[model samples]
Target: MNCLKKTVLFTLLLLGISLSAQTVRKYSNEFMNIGVDAAAFGMANAVVASTSDVNAGYWNPAGLLKLEDNQISLMHAAYFANIASYDYAAFAMPLDKESVVAFSAIRFGVDDILNTTQLIDDQGNIDYNRISLFSTADYGFTFSYARALPLDGLNVGVNAKVIRRIIGDFASSWGFGLDAALQFETKSDWQFGVMARDITTTFNAWNINEEKFAEISGAVEGQNQELPETTEITLPKLQLGVAKKWVFHYDFSLLTEVDFNFRFAETNDVFSSSFASMTPAAGVEFGYIDLVFVRVGAGNFQNITQLDGSDSVGFQPNIGVGFKYKGIQVDYALTDIGDQSAALYSNVFSLKLDWSLFR
Candidate 1:
């Protein structure tokens, strides 16, 4: 049909725009990178290799294959001293012995932002009633599928993501992206995983409401003469991880993991270059009788240049605890402890439930 052809052409044009190097940005759609599940956050996002729950839909979908039953997860956290809210929910189920599927959603937003642009009226009179409230938000919805490979220890997965961004009535955009992941387990009990995010370069075509923007265009002279860029491109990123577990006394266990995150462009990460940058993270979890857990992690390593032209390394540290009983789990994490990094400390809590819990 003619309509279908036009749609296809439009998609191709968007892809072409995303492929252009000049249009790409390093942190476009960064809300998705904030991560979900307090347990994973507590681990400094180093669970890519050992994740095996509903939240795996966001970390590494291939781990979904380890799901033994239908599961649901929910999390809520506030950032910047409660000025912003971040929430997540997910559901996962096994399709058969060797296949699984999951769906997840995330929302990050600042609500009730005062819109003071209309405070001064055309008559040079200030009207208190002109002030209104609006919200700026970003949302991501993902569908994931995973299946076992012919190789004994190999599994593969994929994710289809839909991103939505809103800045009150002034602007809005929608984006689409894809992710691929692999997980492998060795006979020695070591687990390895690799995740390719935004594999095809996500593109968002912004729709700016010129009429609404005109209200504040002249707030600053010479700065509002032109409209903002309409296209945003998110380049690809990669993550590699490995993990292992050890048991002691037949009732206590320890799990440790390390991950390396790679970005295509130069950055101030621990390892940086003109072509790429890498940030390494490590985490450990100690479990007592498979019911109580304690976790610690460190990540987000970056080199900061001080005013004296001296550079220093900074990282974030996190700690967490969890308890599970009757197919229900509760987790809490304190992230960015001691404020060693630029980010503020946050307390995150999450809940997980198995379908059997309700039966």
Candidate 2:
């Protein structure tokens, strides 16, 4: 927080904004919105209203205020036939009786891509030695803080993030954004949550190294292409969710949740679209005395009957199970990607550690 540091931060922020202006597009960074962790994804990301763990910082930061203990969580996912991987790590600590803070990081990467170039000889034969490998990756770091409001059962929170994207070694970009959220609960176990992501709109500045492109082109003939330098902008999105809990049979309980998502883009004017593009999601969880859990959910349903020729209305499904014991928890989930040609399934595994047990 010194003057020099502040100056550097401001410079970077301005650079990102200026570069991203050239190539800004609606929802340019959708990957950041993809839910992480098996439990959240398995519940169709409906936990926004009722989340109470470390992952809450990512889904609904206000939910972090519900935690009474320090905890850490890690998750790894295999996506799209193992060609890509996603990982998340988070740590949450209570600042006081009514306030909490958390730090989290996420990474998504695709590796082992073959870098092919044209052969120098005219025999039309490919040179195996000329082929190399490269990878693309996206990274994000989030710092969040939450506190209970003076109103009973009400909490508010905020998240600040730094983002970086890399493509092979030739291109890279930097970005930053802010998020705000609120959560409310009633005596009847009814909960509501609202979140605004990228409220100020995130900007990314792309820096392409033309010299690297030239070196690659020089090695291979007629295989070079010019690279475009530009920036990307992500518009603000709103998420609203509600949940209810039903308790019965001594230690058994059923939790149900529903969520609505809205995207605000220059192309999709909110006044005109009304609710046409709102995506609705629902999920259910069956829990036994906080020891074992089963979850199932589906969401992002669209008819597309009149808009497109396809009459298919299949919704993506997710299933997961979890076990908890002595402050240690493990979870696994399988999600359908809804793509016929690509990998049919994506898998996620997560582990959690609650330090309160040791205390």
lDDT of 2 by residue, 295-323 (tens): 99887654434345655455667889999
By summed lDDT, which 10 consecutive residues of candidate 2 come out lowest?
267-276
Q: List ranges where model 2 is wrong by over 4 Å.
A: 1-22, 118-125, 213-226, 266-276, 303-308, 337-343, 357-359
Best by lDDT: 1
lDDT of 1 by residue, 117-169 (tens): 67788898999798787777889999999999999989999999999988778
What lDDT does each candidate get? 0.87, 0.78
TM-score of 1: 0.93
Query: Model 1: clashing residue pairs?
Result: none
How much does candidate 2 score in TM-score?
0.84
TM-score of each: 0.93, 0.84
